[model samples]
Target: MEATRLEPRTLVNGDMVAIVSPASWPEESVPAWIARQVESWGLHAVIAPHTLDRRGYLAGSDADRAADLNQAIRDPEIRAVIASVGGCGSFRLVPDVDVDALRADPKMLVGYSDITALHQVWNAAGVPTLHGAIAGAHGDHVRRLLMEDADTVVEADRGALSAELTTSGSVEGRLFGGNLEMLARSVGVVDFDVAGGILLLEINRAAGLGMVDRALTQLRYSGALDGVVGVALGSIDQFAGYEDRGWTIVDTLRDHFDALGVPVLGGLPLGHIEDLVTVPLGTAAVLDVDHGRLTVDSPSGD
Candidate 1:
């Protein structure tokens, strides 16, 4: 039997949202900006105790980061938990997260990039999570996704690097996957439901196209990509002009995706890019490559 899908209640005026640093610490002013943004939506924002703490690349020690996240999860007043920024180290806090507590009291967990780690955990726990940048210019867009009741439509951006690469037709399924590196790393180590979903693929600056090739290959061989019905490609930043042995990033991505042979819609502006859109993962999405559009529905309880 399939586990019933769970959707956290949408945000309302005056609801308190926890600003946390479950990954690497954000810029000194990011949390404050995020707080002001939340207030602009008529919502309250609480900066978690460890949001500003920095211990190396991480926001703080794993225990401290996890404590802040767990507190937000268990708190009745916190209607959402939003990561201030995404750098690295979220995977380290996974073991210490109170996923069960979140399952008992579902609320939104929003962020992208490194926060992909926590998104997978939350989505696996049966609640939906949002993938987007927190402090970027798109905060208003993120606000609407969390606060409004409407579907999200992401049209392929012709200007984006991934725009030229896509498969044929359209397919609908739950939207799964995020930062390619994170998803690849999660395989075997972390368990989640990707079966029968549309995989969302995106990447940031990496050493080379080999990193992209390896991540996709790992997903293919590890059976992690099994049962995925379609693919939605997002920003592949800093890889357009890059070439590894004359193979462009697009060439590398097409090589792997061609084998999956699923409907793939590329250039959705929802990844590690500025002017990003907030998208709900662990929910239904229609990926239409022929029409160059992807429509996403928020997760709803069965």
Candidate 2:
């Protein structure tokens, strides 16, 4: 299938950006601080009505979270949608989303971790979204991407980041991937397709080697690994008892993925980490593993 690249909507001064909690609601202090930071960017920040509501582990009921997300996608005035935080529950709201509406009016959709569900949804709908920092991210990180086009290789500090040309040259393809766990859950559901595309993935506290192994196994078993053009591994942050593990996480995965015959780079500063880099999912990008960089092409006619 030919890749469809979506043009990024420019954020004019005074434009509004909706901040919604599609996954988890951040603590009161953090969300408040984030809001102030957004306003400083010259773009108005409109926090969704239920962004602060909490129902156990979720930001709110599934319907409530889904409603805010849907409303943000359809809101013409809102040029971008930033997630509040990512814990869990975003997947529960995916089936309820109106993919057609989102596709009709695509904009910047940014978040990581649990927000992977939305990435998959947008990918299947042929819309490009961003897998990057949420509203709860550090103020500087959020401000950087919103201000202008950013170019930097992001990787976890502990994990190794390597730029090696595994393939003879670079290939441009649509970006598709997110949190390993959330992506694993979408394996055979007909929504996740990794074929002939660049896969950008990262994990968080649940970085047990076994957990990573299981998730990768699921991707391999479900035929999602077939024809994957390249693999970009983002930060796999502090794992519970990760230090106790005898082998480094990157080394373990490297042994497994080496045979895939595609470029695999690590140390992407993404996932549940500070200074996260935003990647536009479903967009065409040139993955130059040889030169150690990924360049997102300006959407056609932009």
User: Which prediction has the highest TM-score against the true structure?
Assistant: 1
Q: Lowest lDDT 10-mer window, candidate 2?
A: 158-167
Indicate the TM-score of model 2: 0.85
lDDT of 1: 0.84
Error of 1 at 4 (Å): 5.6
| Candidate 2 local lDDT, residue 212 | 79
State the lDDT of candidate 2 residue by residue for 1-302, as single tens digits.
34764555656679788889998888877666656767887889888999999999889999999999999888889877888788889889878888777777767677888889888887887766777774434445444444455433343333243222133456667778888889988876636666778888777756467777788888877777788888876765465335434765655566657757787655556666666677667767777666656766432122
Put down candidate 1 lDDT per residue, 48-135, tens digits, no spaces: 9999998999898888898999999999999888999888999888788887788888888888888898887987787888888655
lDDT of each: 0.84, 0.71
In model 1, the runs with Cα more than 4 Å from the true position are 1-4, 300-302
Candidate 1 Cα deviation (angstroms), residue 292: 0.6
